[model samples]
Target: MTIIEQYGWNTVWKDKWNGKYREHEGRDLLPGRIIGDFGSKFRVITETGETWGELAGRLRHTMTDSGEYPSVGDWVLLAVQDGGEHAVIHGVLPRSSVISRKAAGNTRDEQIVASNVDTLFLVSALNDDFNVRRMERYLIMAWNSGANPVILLTKADLCQDAELKIAEMERAAPGVPVHAVSALLGDGREALLPYIRSGQTVALTGSSGCGKSTMVNWLSGRMLQLTQDVREGDSRGRHTTTHRELFVLPEGGIIVDTPGMRELQLWEDEGGLDLAFGDISSLAAGCRYSDCSHEREEGCAVLQAVAEGVLEEKRLLNYRKTQRELLYQSSKEVKQKRKSAAAAVKAGSSRSRNSGWRKEMDEY
Candidate 1:
């Protein structure tokens, strides 16, 4: 296999390159995978070698949103430039999977975390940093990304009741695999090895100070990333990994380590909420009313399950909370789209009026 193949390049990608981008082959356009993203610049590994790359002028100008740009783990076609040292990315391949979240703050835009990921490792430290609710949010995004989600409870050594935490996570994330890993003691590596073998791409994500960087270093068998201690009071670690970057593991397989998120807002939900909360979804199916909201409604199976202790009330509340958040986000997106359309029409009218005025002046 070539160097690019080690980074999860396969015959499928080859077919895509030949079928769509064959015309560019004569112009020295090569297929490469993005390893590092530094805002405007990227580090890509092509068959020839690793090189710095920037988006082509046309690609940058035509991009409509941040998610369209090349991020870590994206496969892009590059044209060699500047004595073969620099490359210009001309096109991004259609992604098989993409992990994204709502842009921070009030913005209603999608921020693509990584693309073409096969598996998403949702890591949460077993210490005070562990929050099942946050894990539920991650699961929603993970299911939406079209990648298999696996929960990894890290820092098992720090927690006295690691088994209990693992059970809790299992209950919270049904149908998803959960494992407790202790990076300090180097335990639980065996359970994780199956997912990290040859040609598969896995991305680790969680809030800051959750042992994600430490897990990366351990999995790579080297200090590929820096590690830091969590604060004594809150158990929150400083942001050790500042950016998202892809690393090819020494043993085999690929991993993308991302900076810890302070808050993860939902971008959009395409049946992801139902998948993440499968138990609740199953219960809702039995409700007398097909569109039962499960709040103070007669014959609501979800409420009945919660009351009967079959389901945790807290879990149901979180599901409802996330459901409402997604609904609100959808409303905001519609309003934003309308606002943008109006602004665009107004600008076009102004430009036309200006052109007509100039023409009249010329006639004068």
Candidate 2:
């Protein structure tokens, strides 16, 4: 296989290039995968070799959303220049899967974590940072990402009840694979190997100081990333990974390591909430009222399940909380869209009036 093929390029991608990007081929444009995204620049790996790339002016101007720009793991068409040292990215291929979250702070924007990922490894340290509620939030984004979600309880050696934590996570994320791994001791790494075999792309994401960088170094069999100790008080590790990067393993497979997120706000939930909270959805189906809110409602199966100890009250509360967040986000997005539309109309009308005045002045 060629160099690009090892990075998950296949005949399907070639066919896509031929069908849509054929024109670029004649202009010395080549297909490359983005391995690193550093704000204004990108590190892309083509068959020729690795090169630094920046978006072409036209492509940059046309892309209005942050998610629309090239990110780590994106396949893009680029023109190599400066004797292969630099490149100009022309376009990005359609992504098979994308992981996104809300941009930090009060902004109604989407941040694309990674694109074209096949599997998402949600890592949480088994220390004080371990929170099942946080894991549930990650699961919602994972399910929405079009990638298979696998929970990785890291730093197992630090925790006395590693198995218990794994079981708890399993219960929280039904139908998803859960494993406890100690990167320090190299235990439980074997179970994760299958997901990182040749041509497979797996992304590791979790809160900062959760052992994602350690896992990357261990899996790559080298110190590909720097590791730091967590704070003694809070068990929170400093942000070891400052950016998202794609690394090709020595043996085979691919891994995308991302910086720990301080805040994980929901972006857009398209049935991800239901998938992440499958147990609650399943219980809700038996409610007498089809639209039962499960809060003080008669014949609410969900409430009954919680009361009878079949479901944890905390879990149900988290489900409701995430549901509310998604609803509120949706409303804000609708309002923003309307506001933008009105501004666009007003701007167009002003432009037309100005143009008419200019024409009248010229005729006069």
Compared with the true structure, what per-residue lDDT tens digits does model 2 show for residues 1-364? 8888889898878888875774574676889999998999999999888999999887786664435788899999888898999998888999999999999988888889999999999999988999999999999999999999999998888899887888899999999999998877889988988899988999999999999999999999999999999998999888989888999997689999999998799898888999999999999999999999889999999999998999999999999899999999999999998998899899999999999999999999
The lDDT of model 2 is: 0.91
What is the Cα root-mean-square deviation between model 2 and the actual structure? Answer: 1.7
- State model 1's lDDT: 0.91
Candidate 1 backbone collisions, by pair: none
Best by lDDT: 1
lDDT of each: 0.91, 0.91
lDDT tens readout by residue for model 1, 201-259: 99999999998998999999989999988998999888898788999887688999999
Task: Name the 10 consecutive residues with the lowest summed lDDT in model 2.
Answer: 58-67
